[model samples]
Target: MTRLVVVGAGITGLAAAFEWRRRRPDDEIVVVEAGDRIGGKLDRIRLAGTWYDTGPEALLGRVPEAVGLVEALGWGDRLVAPATTQASVVLPEGRFPLPAGTVLGVPASADGLDGVLTPTGVARVRAEVELPPLSLPDGDVAVGGLLRERLGDEVVDRLVEPLLGGVYAGRADELSLAATMPALAAQVRGAGSVLEAAAAARDAGSRSRFDADGPVFVTVDAGIGALPAALVEAARAEVRLRTPAHGLRRTAGGFEVSVGTAAAPEVLTADAVILTAPATKAARLLGEVAPRAVDPLRGIPYASMAVVAIAFPVQDVPAGSGLLVPPVTGRLVKGVTVSSAKWPHLAGGEALLVRSSVGRFGDESQLQRSDEELAADVVADVAELLGLSRPEPLETRVARWGGGLPQYLVGHPERVAAARAAVGEVPGLAVAGAAYEGVGVPACIRDAHRAVDALA
Candidate 1:
């Protein structure tokens, strides 16, 4: 039987192990995680006598990988869609419903964006179709740079910035058009105008299997944090917690991995290895065997942020799913999610759960504040934005993720391709994680399967 060692037992690594077991059930698999727990960002905390997810609460149901995995694991019956996805954006005037017929806040026709954008802003977007025909250049370009030139600053600052910030925690001016919004980017290259491109992209989306009338996002009744443990049980791999892989080298048979503390190290020999660690850690391990992959892997930069989970009396909270705050507002809290309103399972509880995200790519100072201070500031912002009285929460918890998100800057796809090509040269080496491809759970799972397939 073949022996395989998987590094970093995050969702990506655990998903790799699961896929491997399906393909080769007889193989021996050992998963080593640097952390004490199996789940990395997908974690939970008890608040107001109920379990609340401190990290991502849901996955895009439109993506088949995560949903398919859920079904394969026999939890299909437990899958729950959000009760309400009608989110709003907090503008200087007040909160307004997120405009429809838009692809990531880029208006398709500028028809329903009256309150979201000023008269001048709407006029600017309307004039986009009348301007000269637009097309993307030969290479990657910043999402904001291209849109701002065609659609004006209001469109980017009010609409695109908040939406992209909620997803990437990075500025639109720095994010890549090709990497972040691939479909819209592709449409932009062929369409006559930005508005035309957005409309075409929206049309394509409406025809998708997971279109508007169906649920777009989903989570389990037990919470997304429970997925890791369920995955561990299903994979049945020998998992070693707090066992960090320090170095890797090629051996005659396969590869040898040095793990554990530097002072007292241990080695594990395996026929194949799947690296699911973050970009930096993966770069260090591939230094000797796959030196060509190291630079690109190390080039990926990360952003730090904190999630402040608070539980308040149901009546004290506002009546909305959530609100996205744009950076132009100069607010410390980037966005707020009303958990009780969004998830059906979390509803009908005495305490209304809410989560606020703080920090961005370049701004780490917000994360440096004390947990109590951060929580208080977020609470104040939420109360102010929702027009709530100065009410105290029943319970509060703060979870900080340093370098939690990878910035997909211009040329990210090329960098990932270069890294993959270099690692493919080695016989039994592959890499997969949030750094290389998409940051969502489904994307990570898809990439994990790709890595496993490479080895097979």
Candidate 2:
């Protein structure tokens, strides 16, 4: 029997093992996780009689990989779409509804941006249509710089920064446009004017998935944690929790992995190995095995963050889904999700759950605070943003994710390719995780499938 070992029991690792088991039932499969739990960032907790995902709460259902996995796991019936998708941005004065028909805060013509942008900012975006033709950068360019030249600094600061922050926990000024927003870069390169390009692209998108009024995101009643739980259950693999892989060595037949403490270590041998650990740990584990890929793997930076879930009476909750705060505002909290409003299931009648995200690239000091301090700061920020009195929450829970989300910097694709090439040199070995590709659940699943297939 062919023996395969998968490290790090996160969604990516679970998906890899599950797919491999489905394709080869006769093979031996073992999954090892350093954490006590299976899910990595897909964590869920119960407080005040309701379930809340302290980590990633929903999956972009538009991706087939996510929806397909849900259906395949027989959890399709449990899937619930957001009741409200409307969100706002927190400004100096207060909250302003995000204007529609914009792709990642890049408006088509700045027509409906009265509350979101200042008069001068609106005029600057409108001027993009008449602005001179600009040549695109050859390889990679910062998203902020590109938009600032085409649109203006005010628009990029006020609009694009918060939107990109919500997704990448990164500022557009430092983020790579080609890696983060390829379509926008391509459109800007082809069209003479940025505004015209945005309009044309929006028009085309209106005829595609972007215009679909259906649910763009989906979650289950048990929370997104249910996804990894189900995948781990379905995978025909022997799971070892709290058992970290310390080292790996290549043998004549395949590979040998050292597990547990160095004092009394246990080594397991396998014909093939799939490492789904985070970038830092994966690099360390492969230091002795694949030195060539170490630099590229270590080059990928990770952003640390914390989530504060506060439960309040439904009466105190807002109507919209959530609100994103721009870094320029200098708020302790970056964003707040009206969990009760976004996922009706989370409401469950009695209490309204609201979760606030804190910290981003170069702003990780906030994450170092104690849970009590972090929660207090988040509550204060929430009250100020919503213009409500600071009322005591019924219950509060804090989840800290250090080095959670990976940063996809400029030339990230090339770096990932180099890492893969180095790993390919070692037979029957592969790496898969959010560090290499997209950070979404769907993307992790897709990456896992590719890793498993590579060995086959």
Candidate 3:
């Protein structure tokens, strides 16, 4: 048998193992997870009989691979888009519509931004449109600096950061546009100004049909975890959960991994290995094989965050999809998803669900907060942002993800290139996750296919 070992049981790993096995039925695959369950971050938590996805709640329809994979696994019927465009951006005054002529992070002329911005802010932003776009080599640009130079600090502060916060889970300065969202960076390069690009798109009628095609987000009835579960079921590989790998050494035949348990550690040899763990963890594992690659992998920074799911009476919450809070005055959170209104499937008629995220590169103090402390701060902030007073949550569930979103800092593409180059020296080793590519479910899935193809 062509024994291949796949590490980690997250969505990326699961999809990889499934695709690998389908292509090579003779290969014996072993999937080991440090935790007792397979779905690493993809999980659903139930509070008062209602389920909420603590991990990625939706998959972007922009990427066909995710939809195709779900269809292949017979999960097509489970996919459902939001009924309306309740998604809005939160401003100092109140919640405002995400503007009409904006695509991704770009706006259609500074005039369109007028809906949520002041004339002064718009003028300041317009000045940047005339300035030249970047001339750097093909690599990730610091989205923060790029936006500030091209749009204005206020635009980056009040508009761009929140839009990006939801995706990168970090500060604008800490994220690399090339690594996180190259499409947005490409927009900057192609049109000199985000406004010009969006205007061009609008003229072409390349607008968002949110209600029909899904409001930029899609999910299943059982929860987002269904996708990973389906892959695991399809693969039927040897799954050893709670069995963290402690060490590894390249034996004469292939390689031996130390599977550690409280009782004892067992050695298992495999002909090939697929490392789907986080970059830091993978670096520790591959240090012996590739020293140069391991250092930068270890250097990649990650931000801690918490997902707070608050349950409320249906009438208590707003009548919109979600509210994204810009980082400028982002007191407590990055955004709030009005779950019951956005996706009725996940809500009871009498109750409402509001999901919010707190703590990024700029808010380390909040990242260190205890669950109760964090919940208290969240309650206060929600009240201010959503216009709720004396609103104690009926049911609140909090999940803390430390070192969750990797920070693809400026010059990240170059570093990633160096790491990829050094990786050629380490045979039978490959890495995949949100850590390397754009931080989205689709990006991870895309990397999974790429890694499997490279290995095969």
Best by lDDT: 1
Q: Residues 1-95, candidate 3, lDDT per residue (tens digit)?
A: 77878888888888889888889988898998988787777888885576678888888765566776777788888887876565677777666
Mark the 10 consecutive residues where model 2 has the least summed lDDT. 205-214
Top candidate on TM-score is 1
* lDDT per residue as tens, model 2, 1-456: 999999999989999988998899899999999888888989889966867898888888766777788888888899899988899888886678888888788888878988788888888888877777877768778888888998888778778888888778887888877777766666777888877667777766656562167588988888888778788778868999989999999999999999976676899999999999988899998898899999999989989888898887556656399898898788988788888888878766777678888888988887887898888888888876765554668888999888898888887877888899999899899999898868889889999999998996
Clashes of each: 0, 0, 1
Please give the TM-score that candidate 3 achieves against the real structure.
0.91
The TM-score values for the models, in the order shown, are: 0.97, 0.95, 0.91
Ten contiguous residues with the weakest lDDT in model 1: 205-214
Q: List the pairs of residues colliding in candidate 2.
A: none
Off by over 4 Å in 2: 196-213
Give the Å shift of residue 231 in candidate 2: 1.2
Tens-digit lDDT track of model 1 for 170-235: 999999988899889878889999998998987887677443564789988877788899888888
lDDT of model 3, residue 96: 65
